[model samples]
Target: MSWVLGLSGLYHDSAAVLLHDGRVVAAASEERFSRVKHDAGLPVQATRWCLAHAGITMADVTHVTWYEKPLRKFERMLVSQVANFPRSASAFRRGTFNWLTEKLWVKAAIVKELGVAPARVLFSDHHQSHAASAFYASPYAEAAVLTVDGVGEWATTSLYRGGPGGLELLGEVLFPDSIGLVYSAFTAYLGFQVNDGEYKVMGMAAYGEPRFVDEVRKVLRPREDGAFDVDLSYVSYHWSADQSYTRRLEELLGPARFPGSGFDPTTAEGKRYADIAASVQRVTEDALVAIANVLHARTGLDTLCLAGGVALNSVANRALLTRGPFARLFVQPAAGDAGGAMGAALWTWHEVMGNPRTLDTPVLPGPGLGQAWDDATIGALLTDLRVKHEVLAPDTVAVRAAADIVEGRVLGWVQGRFEWGPRALGHRSILADPRRADMKDRINARIKYRELFRPFAPSVCAGAEGRYFDVPPGGEQLAEWMLLVAPVTTDDFPATTHADGTARLHVVHAAANPLYHALLTEVGRLTGHPVVLNTSFNLKGEPIVSSPVQALATFFRSGLDVLYLGAHRVEQTGSYDG
Candidate 1:
């Protein structure tokens, strides 16, 4: 049996994935193990876990693949910094420091981490890794692929054609023009952290009008061939050390909003931020649509597979599904840097090893590939924490949790395994009754302690999805992963629906996750509605709670009413301020 280890790191969201034969066996992020949000180190713990999970030592792996090439990235950094000169000094210093320490010598580092010989280590281009992860894991046998993100070595966006065998690069949009960076610059200007808070900006956009759509269009000039260029004069990210948007950008937008600055969404300042967000989101849609159209025009492939961090934009994904050229879409659940692990492994499997690819059958592996704890582990944690808890029978955990949720109690549902991506899915999640209009406000203000505008996703059993939302025309293709947004027609579940009448839906199947599905089934039985408000099980500025200990701590600290850990149940007796 051939075992290949894939790793993506030395950048944000460092992660590792192990493939046995051709199937994904294990995958995890460094943040969960390191307790650092978006840890960008060598993913030592994650690598160790993958090895341990497969019951093999590092030396047992036939090959090790890194997510991206190092020298090429260093070249981009050096050239971009030198071209920008004095303005790039700050970013240069940061990049050089990182390169000197960790970013460079990736092959050496991987060997050291694995205790393997140097010859076993290999690397793929960042975009190639992203492309491989999407196409290899997707259900499509032959599909057009797209990967877009902030600069990776040099390329920022790439398109590919992939079949059962492997992928070929069709086109690419390189450095100095990137939608991801452009959006990130605005994310910074909107007084939010980059990389992490772009989703928040996506959510905030729904609140504002596209008043600045034309003004922002001056920056994102589209090309007839689906390539776009940014007005460099307005973007300082190419030059500025830390700041991404230049003074010219602030001038164009009128003024830069300070971080933590208060403004109502209905007010003028709020409206301005909203309008800018709307314009940028619209531009992003335009670019993605154009790219998809081009991919279709060239490949004539009805199926599309996408990865890279920008593919995490559900809004653009929806636009591609509805208005763009693709008939079917498959976005790897963990489409960001975390997914590079899968890509690196696949690149080695298909490209280097000369192994032919096979189409994944209808049964797509839902991303529940992280670590899981049994009842014994949960019991030990409860004993150590000295928390009050009861050990219910395995068959009754979901039913009990569903009853509590039906009673309007927010439940921290920690079961089976942790999800492999940014989304919680069924494994690591806080669940509430979607029918309660007050549920959204309560969770955001009390349990999540996040912004009021942040929207929560709805977890509907596949059978119940059609009752509430208009599934994409292709029907039940992309819903399983919660990668697409669909309009919810039913007003009964207002709490789960966003301002735009759309809900980021996770269509759960009983076969994929029995307990979570049973819980939703029970909830439907009680309330006559089969939807639950689902969000990542974590507080703001924290990675998704990984271990049972973290989940318990999060539960005690937040206003969550109860936590169901497999056969265990721990209810929060503390009063919530909200």
Candidate 2:
């Protein structure tokens, strides 16, 4: 049996994936184990966990694959620093220090970390990893693949054709002309963290009109050939990591929003920022649509597989589904750097190892591929902690949880394995009543402790998705992964719907997650709505809870009225805030 360990790190969202005999055995992000949001170091703990989960040691592994080529990336960094010269001195110094210390010696580091021979280690290009993660994981036999993200090695945006043998790089839009960086620069200008705050900007966009689209176009010039360029004069990220935008951007628009300042949409400045957010989001969707159209024209394929940081933009994804030429789409759940781990492993198994592709090899069981605790272990922990709880069967647990949700009680739902990606697809999620308008605010203030503007996603029964969402003709695949933003048809579930009447909806099929589907079915029977407001089961700035212990801790720390852990129903007797 061949065992391949895939790793992605030294940037953000480090992760590890284990492929046993060309099948994905386990995969997890470092943040889950490190408890750091977007941990950038090598995923030591995650690697060990994956090895343990696979019941193997590093010595048993036949090959180790890294997501990206470190030397190639370092070369690109050196060239960019030289191109920018004196202005990039500080960034150059920092880059040089990082590379000399760690990044340049990635192969050596992997060898040392895993205690494996140097010959066993392999490296894949950054875009290749992203493309592999999308196309190989997708159900499609042959499809067009697109990967767009901030600079990786040198390429920022890439197009690929995936078929029996492997993926072929069709074309690419190189660094300094990246849509991902352009969006990130605007994300920074909108008073949010660059990598972390892009979603917040997407959420905030719903509140205003795209009044700044013309100005945003000046920053990102889109061409008819599905390629785009960023106006370097307005962007400073290439020269300095400290800031994404320069003074020219402020002059083009208005004063940049100050970081950490609360968003007040009623105020003129707040309204202006919202408009800018809307404009950027619109421009991003336009560029994505253009790119998708080009890929479709070239490949003439019905299905498209998308990966990379830009692929996480559900709004743009939905726009592409409805308006672009592709009839169907599949986006890797962890479509960011974290997913590169899985991509590296698959690329090695199929492309490098000369293994033939199978029809069933690409499909995942579900997103809930992380660790899970059995009832006995959970019960023992609850007893040890003196937590008041009752054990119920799976069906009863679903029924009670549905009742609690319908009664407007927020619940911490932890069942089965935790989800592998950034989304909470039933397991490790906070569920609440979606019908109440005030529910969103309550969860934001009492549980999440996040910005009120950030919208929550809805977990709906797969068959019932069309009842509430204006799902496009070919949105089934996108909805299954919660990768599509669809318009809400009714105001019944106000909490889940965003200000723009759209929602990032997760369609839960019984075959994929029986317990979650049962709960949604019960919820439908109780309230005529098969949807529940769902968000990741974690507080602000923290990774999602992975273990029963973390789930219990978060349960007592937050304002959750009920805690569902496997077959146990935990109820806090008194008000105890951690």
Candidate 3:
């Protein structure tokens, strides 16, 4: 038996993945275990948990692989600092200090932390990890792979061909010219954190027109062949530490939004920010579409595997499917650096081990690939807390939870393994009825405490997705992972529908998450529509709840009416309404 441990960390979204032969035994981000949002430390807890879950330890693993070539990345950083010279003094000093102290000693760190042999530590290229994460796990045996992110070692964008043979490197767009960084620049300009706030920019785009596309084009121009020419003068990510944009970007886009300032779209200032966001999103979607077309032409493949942080743009995914050349799109669920860990493992298995791509590998393991607690564990915790709760029967839990939502009661739901990606899915999700018109505002104000423009998603069973959303052919794959945004054809479910009449619809599959699928069915039976509002079971800036203790604590603190921890239930009033 061959056990391969894959790790990606020390920058952001640190994670660990355990792959045995062709099976993904376990995968998890450190943030979940560490309870630190985007935790960048070594994935010590996550890696240990993975090994424990598989009844093994680091010593039992055949090899340990890192997601990126750290030395190559150091080379990029070193060259970039020298090229930028005095301008990069502070950023270089800080970066070099960290690299010298920690990042450069990755092999030593892995060996010390995991107690692994020195020679067993392997490293894979960053883009290759991103490519393997999507392709090897996709349903298509042969497909085109495209990975675009802010920067990975040196490549910001990469293209590849995947088949039973192996991945083929087609091309790359190096750093200092990245669509991902360009979008992140707008993210910072709009007064949000770079990597964490790009999704907010996507949501903010729906509120305004793409009126500033011309101005945005001046900063990032897309090529006919699906690449972009980014103006480095207008951006500061390459050199600056305090900000992603420079005075030149502010001059080009008008005054930047002040950080932490009140933003009301009814005001002209907020409207301007929205328009800029819309413009950036439009340009980004167009550039990705162009890239998809070029990759499609290059590979002549019907399916495309997309990964990287940029692929998490759900709205752009809808565009790529409807307007691009590919008939199908498969975006990695863990599309960010966290997924690079899983991809590195898969890359080692197939690309390095020379294993044939098997039908089993293409099944696309469900997102419930992390820590899980059984009913007994949850019950024991409730008892230990001296909390009044009911031990629900496994068969009746879904129906009772559906009834709670139907009665306008909000539920903090925790079940099975926490999701493998950033999305909450049905497990570790807060649920409310979408039919309630005020549900979105209520959750945003009282529960999530997030920006008003950030809309909640809807969860519907896979086959029933068409009834609520105008999902196109092959959209099921995207919908299963919350990777695509689709138009809500009707106003039947109002809360899940965003300003642009679209929802990042999550399609629950019976095989993948039977409890969630059943809950949706019961919801449809009670409300005549299966759709329900779903959001991650975390407040604005926290990682999703991983354990029953976290779930119970969050439920009591938040405005949630009830808590469902596995087959157990806890209600605030101590009275069962259903």
- Model 2: residues >4 Å from true position, as ranges? 575-578
The estimated TM-scores of all candidates read 0.97, 0.98, 0.98
Candidate 1: C-alpha lDDT: 0.86
- Give residue 443's lDDT in candidate 3 (0 to 100): 93
* CA shift of 104, model 1, Å: 1.3
For model 1, the superposed segments whose C-alpha errors exceed 4 Å read 360-364, 574-578
lDDT of 1 by residue, 1-578 (tens): 98998998888999999988877888899898888999988899999988888899987898999899899989988998999888788888887998998777787777776697899999899999999998888767799999999889899999999986579889999998998999898999998889898997898888877778777777878898888999998888887657888888888888877887764688988988988888889989999999899999999999889898988888788888899988888888789999998899988988999887665442226678888888998888787767778889888888898889888999888887688889999899999988899999899999998888889999998788888888886536567878788888889987888988898889999998988989889988888887899999999889998888888878888999888887888878832223
- In candidate 3, stretches whose alpha carbon ends up further than 4 angstroms from where it belongs are 361-363, 574-578
Give the clashing residue pairs of candidate 2, or none: none
> What digit string (tens of lDDT, one per residue) describes model 3 on residues 206-308?
8888999999998998776678899888888888777788899888888998877766877888899999999999999999999988899899998989999
- Weakest lDDT window of 10 consecutive positions for candidate 2: 569-578
Candidate 2 per-residue lDDT over residues 408-460, each given as its tens digit: 88999999888878989999999999999999999999888999989999999
Model 1 clash pairs? 91-241
TM-score computed on alpha carbons, candidate 3: 0.98
Positional deviation of residue 319's Cα in model 3 after best superposition, in angstroms: 0.7
Provide the lowest-lDDT 10-residue window in model 1: 357-366
lDDT-better candidate, 1 vs 2: 2
